[model samples]
Target: MDFDNFKTLGEWDKWKGALAKAVDLGEAIGFNENTVDKMAYRIGNFLSSTVDPENREERVLQELWKVADESDKKVLAKLIVRMVEKDSRLH
Candidate 1:
C-alpha cells in the first residue's frame, strides 16, 4: 500500500484515520482519569522527546522504568512503544 502505487486517491485515507486515532489515544492517555492529565502529559511528553520515530527503545524503557514500578513500567513501556510505532507507520 505504498502511496506511489495508489490507484484511487482515497486509498490512503485509512492511514490518515489510523494516524488520527493513534494521536487521539495518546492525547487521551495524556489526559488520564486517575493520574491527572498533567502527570500523564508529562509521561507522554517524555516518551515523545526520547523516543520519536520509535527509535531508542531501550532508552525509552529506561526512562519509564525510573518513574514506574517494575511490573507496571513494563506494561506501560510496551503500550507506549506500540503507540509510537503505530504513529510512525501511519504518519
Candidate 2:
C-alpha cells in the first residue's frame, strides 16, 4: 500500500506483485481496464514529476516519460497495466 516503496523496489517480481495488487484494488472499486489505465497514467505522471527513481525499472520509465509526448505516455501507462495483468495471471 505504500506506493513510495515501488520506486525503490529492486526485484522485478516484487514490483510486479505490488502493481498487480494495485490493479486488484482498482477492480475492487469497479474500475475497468480503460479507467484503470487512465488512473495509471495519472500515477505515472505524479511519479515522474515528483519522485526520484530508486530502481532500474523506475529509472527507465522516468527516462521514457521524459521523452514521451502525452499520447505516448498513455500508451506507456496502458503497457504497464498490461504487464502487471500478465504477471498477475501467473501467480
Candidate 3:
C-alpha cells in the first residue's frame, strides 16, 4: 500500500493498515505508541518524498531523525528503514 497518492478514505484505510503493521513491528522491537507514532509520521513523509524510489539510506535516516526526538530518532529510523527494505526485497 502506497501513501503518496492517498487522499480518499479507502486509501487512508490501507495506509492505516500499513501503519498498524509498522506499529506492530515497533512494539515487537520494544517501542511504545508515542514512539511508534513518531516513526509512522516519519515513514509517511519519507514515502511522500519518493523520487527514484530505490532509496537513500542516509536521507531516510536524516529525515526520520529530523521528525523524531533525539532519543527515539535512531530507533525510529531503524524501524522505518527495515520496513521499507524488507518490503523492497520481496518486490
Candidate 4:
C-alpha cells in the first residue's frame, strides 16, 4: 500500500480500509492473531509518534495513545485489529 497516498487522503473510511487490508494481508501471510496484534501495536506507536492526526477519529486515538500505558496501548492495538477483522468479515 502507498502510505504516502493514504496520508494525503486523510479519510476515516480510507484509514479503516487500509487497516482491514493489513489485517487481511497478515492472515494471508499466516500470522497468528497475537503476531498481528503486536504488529498493530508497533504501527500504532510509529503513527502516534511520527504522524499528525488528519481527522477527528485519528485525533481521538492520538489523545488516547498519549495517556495509555504500554499494556493499555497493546489492548488498544488488539481492539483495533479485532475491529477491522470483524468489519472485514461483515463485508
For every candidate, C-alpha RMSD to the true structure in Å: 11.4, 5.9, 10.7, 6.0
The better-scoring model by lDDT among 2 and 4 is: 4
TM-score of each: 0.28, 0.84, 0.37, 0.86
| Candidate order (TM-score) | 4, 2, 3, 1
Which should have the higher lDDT, number 2 or number 3? 2
Question: Once model 2 is optimally superposed onto the true structure by TM-score, how far is the C-alpha of residue 87 displaced, in angstroms?
Answer: 0.4
For residues 1-91, what per-residue lDDT tens digits would candidate 2 score against the true structure?
Answer: 9876664664666777998999989999999989999999999999899998767777899999999999999999999999999889887
Candidates in order have lDDT scores of: 0.50, 0.89, 0.56, 0.89
Candidate 4 collision pairs = none
TM-score-better candidate, 1 vs 4: 4
Write the residue-wise lDDT of candidate 1 on 22-77 in tens digits. 55676666733333323434555565457533223445555665677646654664
Kindly list the per-residue Cα lDDT of model 3 for residues 1-91, writing each as its tens digit. 8654344445534544565566667778998756765776566456646633223444454565557665675566456545654554454
**Across residues 1-91, which tens digit of lDDT does each residue of candidate 4 receive?**
7786565555877788889999999989999989999999999999999999987788899999989999999999999998888878887
Pitting candidate 3 against candidate 4, the one with the higher TM-score is 4
The reply for model 3, stretches above 4 Å from the true place, is 1-12, 51-91
